[model samples]
Target: MAISPFRIYDIASTFLQHSLHLTSTLHFYARSKNEYSHGIIYVRRLSMNLNDYLLNKHLLLVDDEQELLDMVVSILNEYGFYNITTAKSIKDAIEATQKLRPELAILDVMLPDGNGFELMKQIKQYSDCPILFLTACGEDEDKFKGFGLGADDYIVKPFLPKELTFRIMAILRRSYKSENPIVKLKNSQIDFSSAQVIKNNEHIQLTAKEYDLLSALYRNAGCIVTIDALCEATWGANPFGYENSLMAHIRRIREKIELNPSQPVSLITVKGLGYKLIVE
Candidate 1:
C-alpha cells in the first residue's frame, strides 16, 4: 500500500512477458521477488493520492489472452487496484458484470465471443461506470467508434504499462467527478481525497490489503460481497487458498475502523453469502 507508483510503473513498463502460467490458466506476473502476489493497492478519491482513488471500484477486464490479462492484472495490482474481476469472452464479461457490478471496465478490442464494442453495449445496460478500450487496434476508425460509443479512454497495445496505469488512474479520477469526496460510515468516515479514516477524533491508517478489502465491501456498500469476490479483490485470479487470509484481514480491519471489533456494526458478516460494509 505504501509502494510508490513510479516503482510499479517502472516495473510494468519494463516487463518482458505480459502474461504468466498458473494452474493451466494464464495470469499476469511481474519479474519480481513475489511473482504471484496481487501487485497494486489504492482506494478511491478525485484528488490527493490519485492511486488511492484507484481503490476498490470493482474493475472488469475483458480479453481473450489469458497472458495479457494476467499481465494487466499484475500491473493494476501494483497500481493499488485489487478488486478486479476478469473475463475472457463477451459472454463471460456480461455474466461477471451482472454479478460484480463493476464501477469501471477495461476491455480488449477483440474477444473470443465478440468485440469490445459489443461488450460495451451489453455492460452499459447494467452500469454507467466509465469504460476504457485497452486494445491492439489503433486505427482511427476503431478509435472513433470507441469514442462514439462513449469510451472514457483508449490505449493501443504493445504500449508502456506505465501509460496504461496513468490512463486508468486518470479515468478513475474523472469517473468519480467528486463534488464531495467524502462518505460517512456508521462508526467512521472515509475521506477518499486523502485515503484517510476518522473516528473518535483519531486518524486511522489501513494496511494495503485491508484497505483493498474495505474498498471492495464499500463499493457494494449495503450489499453483500461474496467471499470469493472479496478474495479476487485482493488476490486476483488465484483466490482459492486465501479464505483464511481474508478472515485474518477482516479481523485486523475491524480493529482499526470499528468501535468494537467483537461486535462490528459497520463491517458486518452476511453469514452464508459474504460480508457487507454498511455505511451510515
Candidate 2:
C-alpha cells in the first residue's frame, strides 16, 4: 500500500525518537567456564533500499533566464527525472518551496526580483534542502560568499551540459547514502555493495554515478537531503559544476528498479524539499 506523505513523516519522527531504545536484545553473555575471555557484540540493522529514490526527488530551478531554465529541464527530463518545478524570481522560489519542498534547489545568482544569494538564505529558512548557485558571477568573493552561506555547489555560466549533470549526480549520491547497502523498494531490490539491482527476474548493473546517488539518498532514508549536501558528499568541497549529471543518473536508476519507470511509486517527490525513501 502507498504510504501517505503525512504518515511517512509521522512514522519517521517516531522512529528517530526511539531509535536508541531499540536495543532490547541483550548484547553480552557471561562465560560459563570462569576463564577470563574476551567477547564481541554485534548489532544488525534493518534492510533499507535506495532504488527509485533519486528519480522521485522534486528539484527546484530558480532563474530569470527562460532559456537556461528550459535547457536544464530538458536535460533533467532526458535523464528520467520529471518532477522538477521552476521559478524565475526569489518570491516565486520561496512560494514554490513552501507549497512543495524541493530536495535540491538550483538558483541563478541574478534574478529579476532578487539575487540568488539572498534568496538562498530565505529558502534555507523554508527547507534545509541543498542549494546550487548557477550564475555568471564567478569572482573569488562570490564563490567565497556562496560557500559561506552553506551553498553546496557553485557553477559559473556557459556551463557544459555533461559537466552539469555529472556534478548533480555526484552531489545526490553523497547526500543520500544511508550506510546500509541493501534496499527493498516497490518490487525491486538494490544492493549497493554488489552494484546491481534485481527486478522482474533480471539482474542489472549500476553505473558508478548511479550507485553513488543511491547511497546518498539511502543514507538519509525517510528524510529529505539537499542537493548541495549531496554534491559536497559526491564531488568533495569543489562540487560546483555537476548539477545536470545527477538527473541523468537518476533516470537510469529508475529504469533499473521501477516496474513502471514512467510513474514511480517507490521513489516519491516531496515538492521543494527533497526525496524520501518510503520504508514500511
Candidate 3:
C-alpha cells in the first residue's frame, strides 16, 4: 500500500505526541511506500534525545531556495544542531566542503548553476560524507540517479519538520556508528552509553543537563569550549541567560567526574573563557 506524504505526516505527528508523556525513550518505527516506490521509509519518533551525542556534527545544506534554507535551518536549530553551513549554489557548496568537511550533506536537486547530482560528485572528491537529497524532484529517474551516485537518502520537498529531523538523525546514526561511547578521565571514566561515571569502582549517574554539558565538553576535549558554545549545547538554540544555570551544572558535573571539585585536575575552567575536559 502506498502512503501519501500527508498520511506519513499524520502518523509521525501522532507518535511524536504520544512519545512525550513517557519517561523512558521509545522507538516508534513506521514503514511506508511513496510514489517513487522507495522501499521501507523509516520514520522514527525523536524521543531518545540523541542530540547530546550527535549535535556537534558538521552539516552542509545546499539549496537554491532561500526561504526553504531558512526554514530547514530553523528546524535543525530547534533540534540542537548548531554546526550547520548553508550554500545557495554548487560553487559555494563545493567551496564550503573543501574548506571544512561536513559529516553529512543535504542537497537540493535543482540549483541555479548546477544540479545537486553534480554537486554530490564534486563533494565526493573531498569527503565521503553521507548525502541526503532534499529536493523538489520526485521523479523515479531522479531518485535512481541520486542513489546510483551514492546518495544516502532522498526526501521530496514540502516535507514535515519532524520527518526531516528524524531522517537526518537516522542518517547520522548509520554513518557515524563508530563513535566510542566511553570517555576516560584522570579519576573517572564516563560511559555515555549508560550515562554513568565509574569512579573508583563506584557508579555515579549523571543528570540530563550534566550529560549534555559533559558530552559537549568531551567533543572538544583538551580545547577550550567557549561558554556560549557550552550553553547552546546544553540549553538550546537561544542560550542567553543560561550562564548561571550552566555554572551550576558544571559544578555538579565536577563533583561527579573530579576527585576534588574544588582543586580540579580533570575538568578545568579557563576563568574568562570556558571549561576543558582533561581525559586520560
Candidate 4:
C-alpha cells in the first residue's frame, strides 16, 4: 500500500524527536503525496565514520528561522560535521560564502532578504559547491525551479535528520568521489580504488592482503588499530595465528609506502599493540 505523506511525516517526526532527541519545538511540515512523487525520502546505510575525511568539509546552511538553523546545526554536529556556518538571510549567506567557500550548502527557498534560488546563483558565482534545497516550499514548480538552477538536491522541510544527512552525504560522495579515494602520505600515496601506491612517480601494486591491511590502517589513520582488529580486517573471522603473517605484510607495505622501510615513519608500529598510518 502506498503510504500517505502525512503518515510518512508522522513516522519521521517521531523518529527525529525520540530517536534523535531533537527538541519538541522542531516543527515538521508535510506536502501532499503528489508533491512527493519526485522522490524526497532518502535513507541509506552510510559506510562512513566519525573520522571520515568528508566530515571535515565546510558546510553553509541558510535558513530564516533561527530555531530551525540551530536544530539543523546541532543534528549535523552530532553526525560528525564540525565546520558549519549558518545564516538567516541571503546577505549573510553570500558574505559567509565569500569568506569561506563551503564544500556543500543547504538552503531554504524563502529567505527574508531574498529566496534560495537567487542565493544559489550568487554562491555559484563564488564557488561551485553542491547545493540542497531544504524548505517549506514543496510545490512542483519550486522543485523544478531549484533543480533547473543546477541545485544538486531538493529536500522539503520538516525532514528526518537522517534523510537530510543522507542526501548531503550522497551529494558530497557524488561530487567528491574522485578525490576521496587517494590517501596521501608523507612520502607516498595509496589509491584504494586502484589498489596501488604511488611513490617516486611509480605505481606499486598491493597484494590483496596488503591492500586490506593498509585500507584498515588508513581508515583509522593516526590511531592504533589492535593486532586482533588488523587480523580480522585482513583475515577472516577465525583470525587466530596471523600475527607473524600480519607483521610480514606490514614490512612489505612499509617498503612500498615508507621513505626508509627499515625505519618506517608513515606506518609506525605501536610497540606490542598494533600499527598506525600517518597521512600527509
Give candidate 2 regions above 4 Å deviation.
1-51, 179-280
By lDDT, is 2 or 4 better? 4
Q: Provide the lDDT at 177 for model 3.
A: 82
**Candidate 1, 188-230: lDDT as tens digits:** 8876556677889988877778777876666546555667767
lDDT of 4 by residue, 1-280 (tens): 4444422121225555555443322222222434322222311111224336576667898898878987887678556564567788889888888887789999999999989999999999999999999999999999999999999999987799899888888898888877747888999999877899999999999999998888767655555566776777678656689999999999999999988999988999878667778887
lDDT of 4: 0.75
Q: Residue 239 lDDT in model 1?
A: 74
By TM-score: ranked, best first: 3, 1, 4, 2
Off-target runs (Cα >4 Å) in candidate 4 are 1-127, 136-145, 160-180, 222-224, 270-273
What are the models' TM-scores? 0.56, 0.48, 0.57, 0.55
Distance (Å) between predicted and true CA of 25, model 3? 22
Candidates in order: C-alpha RMSD to true structure? 11.7, 21.9, 12.9, 12.7
lDDT by residue for model 3 over 181-265, one digit each (tens)?
7888999999998999999899999999898888767765555566776777777657789999989998999899888899999
Error of 2 at 45 (Å): 32
Best by TM-score: 3
Model 4 / residue 118 / CA error / Å: 7.3
Tens digit of per-residue lDDT, candidate 2, span 88-204 = 888888988898788889889878987888999899898988888888999999999999999989999889877777777666777665544467887798876689988887889
TM-score-better candidate, 2 vs 4: 4
Instruction: Give per-candidate clash totals.
Output: 15, 40, 0, 0
